[model samples]
Target chain A: MAGIVEFEKHPADTLKVGKGFSLAKADPDATPGYSGNKADGEALLADLDGKLTALQEMLFAESRFGGRKRILLVLQAMDTAGKGGIVNHVMATMDPQGVQFKAFKAPTEEEKSYDFLWRIEKAVPAAGMVGIFDRSHYEDVLIHKVHNWVTPEELKRRYRAINEFERRQTDAGTTVIKVMLNISKDEQKARLLARLDDPAKHWKYSGGDLKERAFWQDYMDAYQAAFDETSKDHAPWYVVPANKKWYARIAVQQLVLAALSDLRLEWPKAEFDVPIERELVERS
Target chain B: MAGIVEFEKHPADTLKVGKGFSLAKADPDATPGYSGNKADGEALLADLDGKLTALQEMLFAESRFGGRKRILLVLQAMDTAGKGGIVNHVMATMDPQGVQFKAFKAPTEEEKSYDFLWRIEKAVPAAGMVGIFDRSHYEDVLIHKVHNWVTPEELKRRYRAINEFERRQTDAGTTVIKVMLNISKDEQKARLLARLDDPAKHWKYSGGDLKERAFWQDYMDAYQAAFDETSKDHAPWYVVPANKKWYARIAVQQLVLAALSDLRLEWPKAEFDVPIERELVERS
Candidate 1:
């Protein structure tokens, strides 16, 4: 636990305070701290860019290789858990075309009419696409389980269903990475309070968000259960400590790189059939 | 034209030929040389990651405000004209929570039953969200105009309809940005050839693409007409010279920064009371 917050740096004075909310800060000296490593992360980010550029060249070379391979990343967490920060840094070095993102909100009436996974399934990446789901079907487990919308038996079924769904995708060559950005209860409260005080972040807060905060313990239990049930070999879940945004991002990027490395991509060879005549054009 | 390809290094040597297709190079120095400025482009790409980071903070801050603003980015171009490259760089730095993207292909049977704009309307970003269209209703102008699927009269009507639709969005506080990535005919030929040489890229190439290639002049005429009619103050089109990927990416990012800066977003103040004091458990 001390390692969770130690690796990432948060400006001690950056905390914001407002009418009803207080920003949370991770106790740096805590046992599980944020030790995922910044230098390593920066290096990895650059590496990911180089790898992707190479992959694009290979993918471009084949031309018919279908489309770009789409990677869907799903990050789910409680309020102030650093999901936004994680998204920013992990995608910091990636080419925009290869990545597509969606943030799931409380289902609209039309969305509710369908199965919980319906809107999300539609957001899945095409053959050569990457889809990032800020919050996903795991909501069924996290919220519904906490609020008792579903019974234990039904919730148990969802866990297995999620596992099967992910397995099928991995088998079909779609990399599904699920990250649970876990933050401490105290830190979450602090972050929420900061949101209320900062004018720029005020729009992200709501009066009702407090209601969810009240059930912090309930959410933790649900998340633990979800993890226990769905952490399969094909689709593994990484428990990312969110108290430190840098570590969370680094961990997620590493996961993405590891998953993409499995594809064994290479640059396609160029065929110069028409007899190349190289003419140099100079710019004055 | 010299400004467009000035710093543009032709990567024809980087073109890979695979099993099914051939790779060719475009002479950027040829007549009507590319029109993008490389120095300006480099400066733009260099600042994109940082600018995007600031924009997301501004967006998050703005969301707290009661009023909502939506940004819809429409991308239209010929195949292999760097649409993917443009999308990749422009939106690369945004917070995934506030940004959403959709790529439209040939309409499905269900989609075909509705007016062409129906599916497109469904894709518009809600308040405080940024929506990106890889290929949009402009297809009705580009493809339909060239293929005669719609009469000249119908095509003319769509221009007005699209204009009004965008104006309505603008009136609703949505900022609309339209980008037309302009690649010369010679560039298209090179890309098509590259696709044939690489086995992996073969999936992206189809024999029918060449059929469209044969009528390059007609497509150009159609595109020029579409640009002339649809370009408006509410949703102006940026004719991006895409012979150079780096230049194209920079141009798009600059355009995005310009649009978002116009919003004048600021971080919201937090409102919580009673400071929650937390201790540093560890320090680096």
Candidate 2:
């Protein structure tokens, strides 16, 4: 909500989470910032690929030569909301060298032994990396709240911890982009059915998914509560509509583009005497 | 190598390290399995992207559904030899979620305290991932041998340790691909000059690059000796002719395609009751 004016020139502003915003009021089918159709969205994504890839390379190069700026893109969404599609289509062109991706799952017994942030802290992108998290620390506030996995007081405490945790990331020069791939229950039903129909995609479906879907409204309430509690100036949550897969991909790509472009990345300057090195390389 | 005949249908065989292979004999300009010009190579690479990406996705999907198979593609070469290029162009299409890349540099104080393979072991990709090492344990043998950084006996021990390490990986359902992007000294010189000439690329240029180029023959000997000692049936090193950037990219892509295809991947079956899940999802 605070970033609406900050992102005024970008599509990100259209999806910005304003204070007291309700998920029910937003249309998952709405294109928001874009007036484009599916083909247009795809074409624009393709056009943005070059600038995105270049900026990513520059960011990576900056880290290698002694710079401390990185990007952490945290994606939160219902199942079949196309988080994976955003990664495959929007970020597939990036040099894997500069990309770090982790999809968090149910915590293991060992993970349960430590603070929830312990595993997350280890996965933070180092300088110059674009770290993509499929599901992240917000899960503690979202699902943990929805499922009553923790005490209500403990769940409330997690919100404060998440906000502070993200503030620290900003302190350490990590630009955090938190996104909720907003999709409707109907859209989820259709997608789940599509998965059920396709043998090739059956591996992605599970009985647990429906159990979660049964709590759809509760989950929506959970997401809104989490957003209200943790969304901040440095790492505000932007709810990109997910019903139209093409639009979701393009919007997320544009958000990343704006974040990187804001950094105004430059190729790191040579750390050696260029003239001397040039001569030496010439003789060799 | 032991894998030469095994890789005969692919370009990998043409570049394979046989029992008594000599680095001096291999021409960097030769396009072994391919007879095409640069344009044809580019066309083939474009054509191969679909299959490569599909295979990577299938491999990732398989891992998520109880499959344990994975790949470790170890890239070793001198400076400006196109290791990064191969990753950027060849792996650019695959989902970043499935890739884990590390560019091994000179070890730090903590890393140097452990066995050379400790950091390497940590970086090995988990189930269903493609782990790429820009430079790897082979550095302990190749560069260490070139610079006499380790005692000859200790350096020789590392070869044995590396062989056993790769064997253990294969024993654990990991397929290892070792590729030495073989670029001629002249090609290296030209590339270094090109980097020096372009301000944008200057960050990649290093004064140390010249110091390393001075020991070109030593590096060649180091590479040959290491290959002779450690290239095994499970992971024989492929000596790719890398002067033609297009040829190297295409050859490496084909090699990865061959490796993933060898696994005979299929879409994993639903782990839950499909009928029950479908019924629940529909009602929801």
Candidate 3:
């Protein structure tokens, strides 16, 4: 069993990338925080639902009540690594009004015309909202790096640009949580085959998935290099073990809870007198 | 029961504005496509789930199969008119992988740096995907016009710019579905008060919502003028009655189904010989 876990420190500190972090060295199935069976993990996740919802609500209220802080959860992974599942199962529990979800696709002609981050900047969650990027600006570094889409010097410039961009977001009160859902290639193959076997899931089965699977090693290398360059104190990357979908969801929910709890958000006091407002409501 | 309804023509043609469209003349409580009670409407919405899912899947598949067509659903509504609910209930029913949902908030420093359509053009749904804009480029006309954020001449220029931008989108095979969620003033008051009453919902209650309420008529005028200028054969605006949430959801679902159906999508054929692939799979 794992040692007694500290809610604030356990998964985040351990999952977070340190200097010279290697994706190859990290196990994709490790459940660092919880030493329990699947049922226990699910129960823990269920308990986290209310806590996450409450923290998100507070953060959202604070935005309107003169709190300028916001949270951005960036989920990056290989195809079929459960990024959508995290958005749906975990983040959806929060009030839809407070969550801003942006799924970045390949750049359009106009998007390519600008610096890569322009579209990303436009989609950042406002104050007091939980902004989720299903796949984010990190794609430019990861995929582009894998395919040599940019020159080595240009890629270096992007690393600098990404750091600067994230620092600016932090300065503007956006707490950025970057998570890479780490799943083994074998696990991905199983999931892909499962989709193919189910007729209803065929729409999601893309030839592109197999094409991308062929480049698995290249992607891992790209991820390693990206972590080496861009994982800063302001916006560090957390490698969440996603083979166990339940654990990944719970870990993400806990990370979010920790981030919001760190903010120490309180419901804003009513600007008007409560006694008078009660009487006024009675009169109305 | 109401008279026979043509799914292709009824709501789209009836709800669409003429040259001199007046917001005041449109009733917020009307349910055009639906001729049943709330329960019945909900049942229809429930029924639409599978159909919409199937259509969306095909659309997504067609994209990967070399189809360049896409659909963009642009939702515009007054405060408390249930845009978020529609997104949650209607669009969320489809696979998130194929949907690109963008909620446009107030312009940021970088967004403000570009022309009004610059950020919007960057977010158009990629091929074979369903893109939803919670609030879109139309805001440049609606809010800006109501508040005189732009001069009359500038507003006229913006109208021209918007029409041109949408035309370009249409020419590029993006079928744009523009909907205005029409709600009564009383409905807005009740919805706003409901938020005030619920502590959990307090975060969604914004002071700007009330501030905008003060200029309700100005907003109506802005909508009327903008709709008159921008609604075209290719991208017509549909003023959906949103007071009945269930009815509104079903109506939007039908419209989306109709749009996808118009695409005449078929299941993409497998590139490999099925018999050969079957043999290989059987051996494996």
Candidate 4:
């Protein structure tokens, strides 16, 4: 808990790795929802942008050679947790060619009848593609627990199922990175209210949002249980402080780049067979 | 050609017609590459965001709904023409559940053997989903044309195929919005050069970038042909100015909102079927 506050209040430079990721401090002035040292966060984000571009180029290069490495980034969070802002700020700089995004919604009747992971399984990125999931299967734990949509026995079974699902994905060579955007309740309300007060933002708000707010404690309990149960070495969850969207986005980016770096992917050498002429080169 | 320039330079505020969209001008001085007059863009984006949210809610209102509507937005552009920025600034705010993104790459042998549209068809949004294509099948026209992938006769056939493909999509209730990010050649070179000069941006550049730059004239010729053949009333091209990334994003948002308004799509209704509980209101 102290680690969380320290990261929230101090610069990222001050962070020392603890058991897993060290939470960085949020910059108050960087952007309305952003948290981190403004200058440091900007620099870190810039670095991330460069790294992601390289990763993307490499992925595209891989595609050219028919090499496929599917990567999945799962962002699971409470509402008003800056998931949207995070996606905009962090993934904004990557080349579109190699990246894909999906936002998991409540299971439809058709989906509800199937296993929890069915819809999500279909969303995994194809070979040489990066897929970002905004609010994923963990919803079963977060929403289902709050709503009592299933028995504790069923929920317990799901934790094992999700673990197996992710492990299978890793075995299949799909790099899975999970992030939990953890913001406090007070901060969550402020954001929700912001959406309600602004007409332009009204579309993002709904009557049901308040209903979810009422179960804040229940959600926290559910999330804690989830992290305790499923934080594996392969697909570990980075507990991001959503109070500052900027720091969270940067943290996520750094984690992603770090993962891709581990893969040591290379760009494909172009095999251009197109007619080449001095005139075309100069004119092109 | 002047009409192209005129349309390119037009600010988003002037374009706000109906459907709660008001063109926004970003404040130029807020930060480098950060729009200052963002309030207006936010307003317009928020309007579209709300409309999209309403549409999704309508489609998924039923827990056991059988069918869903899908929308695909295709963005085709020259290098340094702000595709990434537009995706972040305009469409980034939409709920991820209702939206999907696919960035098509150079064709693999499998894709190359099939018709040009084969890979593109694989990425179209499912019903109730909004699919965004960053650089799509049009690449065969723009880049392939410049590189002479096929003879004039073959290229001509591709144009008709593209026009018909989008038409069939709209007839199937898929709202197809296409944008051609048109930037002056000088502007593009400036951007490319910026990438070269800035160490942080160097990774974004490649050797082929200059080669492609040399073929500017050829690309322009190809794009002109594409525009002439495919700019039908249903799926017209909005030739946006690319010099100002913020303005271009706003313009694209305006075009998207306009299409949604024309469809007169209604918001999904919330079906409250569970028994009312006193605690639910209290908790909320």
Best by lDDT: 2
TM-score of each: 0.74, 0.95, 0.70, 0.61
Error of 2 at A203 (Å): 0.9
**Candidate 4, A1-284: lDDT as tens digits:** 11121124322222212243323232222332234465667676765577687786676567556776767888887777878776766774665556677778777999989989999888888777788898899998879988899999999999999999999988877788887777877677667656544444444555677778878788877876787678787777766666777667776776677677877787554343223322233344
Which candidate's DockQ is highest? 2
Tens digits of per-residue lDDT for model 1 on A155-242? Answer: 8888887887777677776777777776787677677667655555655666566778778878877876777677666666656666
Ranking by DockQ: 2, 1, 4, 3
The candidates' DockQ values read 0.23, 0.68, 0.12, 0.14
Model 3: CA > 4 A from native: A1-61, A64-68, A92-174, A192-237, A267-284, B1-26, B30-54, B92-124, B135-168, B195-233, B270-284
Give the per-residue lDDT digits (tens) of candidate 4, residues B150-254: 899988999999989988887876877777676766677667666555544544556677678878778877866777777776666656655667556757766
lDDT of each prediction vs. the true structure?
0.65, 0.87, 0.83, 0.66
User: In model 2, which residue pairs have backbone atoms overlapping below 3 Å?
Assistant: A1-A17, B1-B17, B1-B18
- For residues B1-284, could you state the per-residue lDDT of candidate 2 as single tens digits? 11111122577677788888989999999888676778777888888898998899899999987889999999999899999999999987888878888989899999999999999999999999998999999989988888888998898789889999999999888999999999999999889888988888987877788889899999999999998998888998899999999989988998899899999999998777778777878888
**In angstroms, how far off is A75's CA in candidate 4?**
1.5
Candidate that beats the other on DockQ, 2 or 4, i.e. the better one: 2
Tens-digit lDDT string for candidate 2 (A1-284): 11111122466678888797888898999887566577777777877788899999999989887888999999999999999899899987898888988889999899989999999998999999999999999888888888889998898778888888999999998899999999999999999999998988998887788878888999999998887887788988999889999888888988899899888889988777878887877887
- Chain B, candidate 4: TM-score: 0.77
- Expressed between 0 and 1, the share of native interface contacts present in candidate 1 is 0.38
Query: Residue A248 error for model 2, in Å?
Result: 0.7
Off by over 4 Å in 4: A1-43, A66-70, A269-284, B1-100, B103-230, B237-284
- Give me the runs in candidate 2 sitting further than 4 Å from their true place: A1-9, B1-9
DockQ of 2: 0.68
Q: Which segments of candidate 1 are over 4 A away from where they belong? A: A1-37, A52-72, A92-100, A110-115, A118-120, A160-175, A189-198, A206-214, A264-284, B1-40, B60-65, B187-209, B244-246, B268-284
The TM-score obtained by model 3 is 0.70
